[model samples]
Target: SGAPGSRVLITTRNVNVSRTSGVSEANMYQLSCLSDEDSWSLFKQRAFSGKSSDDYPELVPIGWKIVRKCKGLPLAVKTMASLLFCEFNKDKWEDILRSELWELTEGKDKILPSLKLSYHHLPSHIKPCFAYCAIFGKGHVFDKDRLVEMWMAQDSITTTARQCKEDVGRRYFEDLLQRSFFQKSRYFDSFVMHDLIHDLAMFICSGDCCEVVDGKLSSTSRVRHLLCRNERDFRRLLSCGCTDDLLKSSRTCYCVGDSMEPDDVDGAFFMKAMEGMFMKMKYLRVLHFLCIPEITELPDSLGNLKHLRYLHIYASGLTTLPESVGNLLNLQTLRVETPELNGLPRRLKDLVHLRHLCITGDFLGLTDSMGNLHNLRTLEVQSDKLNDLPESL
Candidate 1:
């Protein structure tokens, strides 16, 4: 494929392949690992981007010890650097320095093993939190706020006396963010787990908590977190039909990536299949129907899911949620984008545990009973027909 002036530069871990591909010794470029000084410089640049050496005099020695273990590999150094970013506590730095994960491997493949050390040191409460991330596809950027709410829905976060459940979830997210498990996306307040980190999560979570229904619908009795790459993949699986036992215990059903365009398939058939699937997933705590405009309404049986915590209706279809939805007292986060929606159930006040609510619609007014939602933390409503604002608001 190379033109007269076009040059192809290949990067690989195998040297024999490079030789066989006609790369002579003169053309071969071997990348050597960084030296101790260079490694520390790179690590420090990422970990304490804005801080001067005088800012944290005590952490320098500890940082050096941690950097030395990186074995001069930039990836290892950068990974650890990102892990320690904005972290200034002496004890945490010492803990990393003393961790035995540094001794897991000896040579070129040391980066993964070093990264695993960080994973191994995660708190018991956050272990499952990290593992559940396998549900997301590679390079998937997630909204931090929504992500925390989803984790709360999955019951992956534990509330402490000083912090509310949402606050606790945020703390967990920060901890993971500090440890290099997540990296910032180009978009604001969005993040992505590095591919290596994602691989580690999948390896730990496989066959236990997360499963992606791609190309096939394998038996999923034990899978609590499920993901479908796109609407097309889901439709293909639906045509084959699902068994009664498949995904029966699923707590999260995420339809990620691209949505189905209006002309992609039979809309009625797609909606019918989705309704049936939702009915079988009675234990679902987190459900996401990403931009499926054909879904005009949700199943009334949706109220039977007492465990439901987070629900997202990105599709612009049905106007209002079924009144039975109020029966989900455990719901924590609700996001809907039904522009035609007219009103919310007066019983919405009964969702005493709800924390976040976002809806864009043609609503009239908030009922006085809205004051009864003592736990509500975030509320966003858009409507042109609304006149009166509740005194309680």
Candidate 2:
């Protein structure tokens, strides 16, 4: 206490000890985990690191689950990621999504319970930050200051994040990240949580969460998202008899993002397969159907979505487009890449509100139909080598 220059690194589980020791004098550098992207990147660095061939492309998406479980903590990422390097394949990823997920996620205590034990053990004042994470699930990423703003929006700051406002909130987030509760990206701008950590957060909310039985749905007010991935909880919504209520209550639905069949991701008709899912999800405002193989035609229901602002069907095998695209009066971003398929959808001639229209793959049909998009700022050119690309240009 007498020494002014004494730089001490205290490692105690008790929040009071650290609080009393440096409350007003010493500077605090709350540790956090690797950022979400970095956590996944680090996790994959080893898994995909020396590997080559076309398989790398398929493996990345499946690896996302494992990344989510690490909650962006480096220790967890380092430990569990070590397990992935040995089993680098789509089958391994599918296996991870299986029953043995628990062992792989929590096997290294540093990865799951151990990291969370530190978070849970924090002072009562800072507990809300940890508890609030249950809504986003593990592996989910959020901006630091933005998360602080949400806490303010939720009024959690009054009870918790009260120190330096933005700084305290940032410190709180940083502390969690450093303590390995939250993960930071290599870029150090964003954060992520592992999937297992997401489960742990849900467990923390047991007081608020209802036991959603199979064929039964549960009612929740404060919570916005429901995460029942593969726990035989399929028909569970039906049992609750409040599926419609839950739908209106939730702004977004969480489901298995990865398609069971990897072939669908690279094949020529992947867009059609994804279109089937899009047609059923009427409430979705933002949908990322990345890496579809190909689409010969667009689903007609797309026009029905007057609320759709962003539609991403990138990295696919695409040729022609559905005329109904112009019908989406609210459309802002339309992404399609069909380099070999040379043609633009004629319907887009009237989509004046669109700001970005990207085409990467072969569009064997498009010539100069894009001139209609007067408001577009960004565009992806798709066509064979030509003397003059868009005649309008």
Candidate 3:
């Protein structure tokens, strides 16, 4: 056997740090959010296992939403899971879900702390990397080495890099990670913003340091939408002229080894990342993701929006849906094209105010009490796969 000194295996959320003085690594693994079934089951076990059958079926679904938002981060699930043990109704779960990072962790310093606490945990050198992210948009993912280079260029690191640059910045980044300030997105070695934590960053950037730092764009800058599906796509996003709307970008990069891969910004799944917004942001009356495909899910929160009249999710991967989707009482037109849809949510029966429902593909089951919605003027799903036509129709 070769000397053990020739190889060493180290695991870290950051890809940049994995590259060494003269060694290449293989078989790196990246993790994504849990499947809906697994997430729902996990939430049910910890949040509702003790409840009686007579009281659960109605409330269990709501718990599933909370788990989905946690994005399968065990740190987040367990922290909130234990806290949820004190509540009795769905409102409490919503309150927890709707809360900002500070709200959940406030006063519970023994349990969690405010940004000051999260910030305080960072070592002297790496504080800038966390703060440096303020330059990127909230929910934006960054290439690890590129970002680390920028962080090193910052005054904080240059002041310290001479002594031991890599270790200094890395230690700070790890500190921020330990304190739960930043999360690693699996596709590349990049970090992503969870909504609440991003809210915290935006809150900070909007406060005394608004001009100096912004985790999100401010009114001062023009809004633009950038959609990139590859590194060439990223270059395309940056190359476009500035505007005032939303700037979306997606990029797929190829690296010879794991150490060089960027995180979070998955070119393949970027469309799913944008699906929820397409349905909800009424301010965004006009939308488009025609450039790419591979999206599969929609955000259930969009159903509560009363002004929304037009919805479209015709992507190939959109095979399942949320039961909360039944609440779209105001929807006037719905369109989709998914080949593997197994069934419609039972709650679809509640949409009595609908006018047009157009699904042009196959589904395993499309019949149930849902046909009772007499208000339907047009229903156009594939007929071949229909398990049964509702007599009530």
Best by lDDT: 1
Tens-digit lDDT track for model 2 on 1-393? Answer: 859897668765356777888654345556666777888767766666556524677777767776776677666666455545546567866665453334444553333653444443465656777666665544556667546544443445543444544556676676556444566756568887766565666666653433343444344554344544322342233233454444444323333233324442334333443354445455544333334343456667667556556565533445556777777776666766545555656788777777667666544444576677777766666556534557663
Candidate structures ordered by TM-score, highest first: 1, 2, 3
Of 1 and 2, the candidate ranking higher by TM-score: 1
lDDT of each: 0.79, 0.55, 0.49
Expressed as tens digits, the lDDT of each residue in 1-393 for candidate 1 is 677898888987689989999999899999999999999999898788678756899999899988888889777788788777888988988888888777676445323766787677778999988888887877788887898888888878887678777778788888888777887999977899877788778767756544346656543546767677887776765666656665577788777667777788776886677667767877889988664676766667778778899988766767667778899999999888788787887788899998898988888888998888898889988889888879886
Error of 3 at 318 (Å): 1.6
Candidate 1 residue 206 C-alpha distance from true site, Å: 2.8
Clashes of each: 1, 53, 21
- Per-prediction TM-score to the true structure, in the order listed: 0.79, 0.41, 0.32
Worst 10 residues of 3 by lDDT: 250-259
lDDT of 2 at 298: 60
Ranking by lDDT: 1, 2, 3
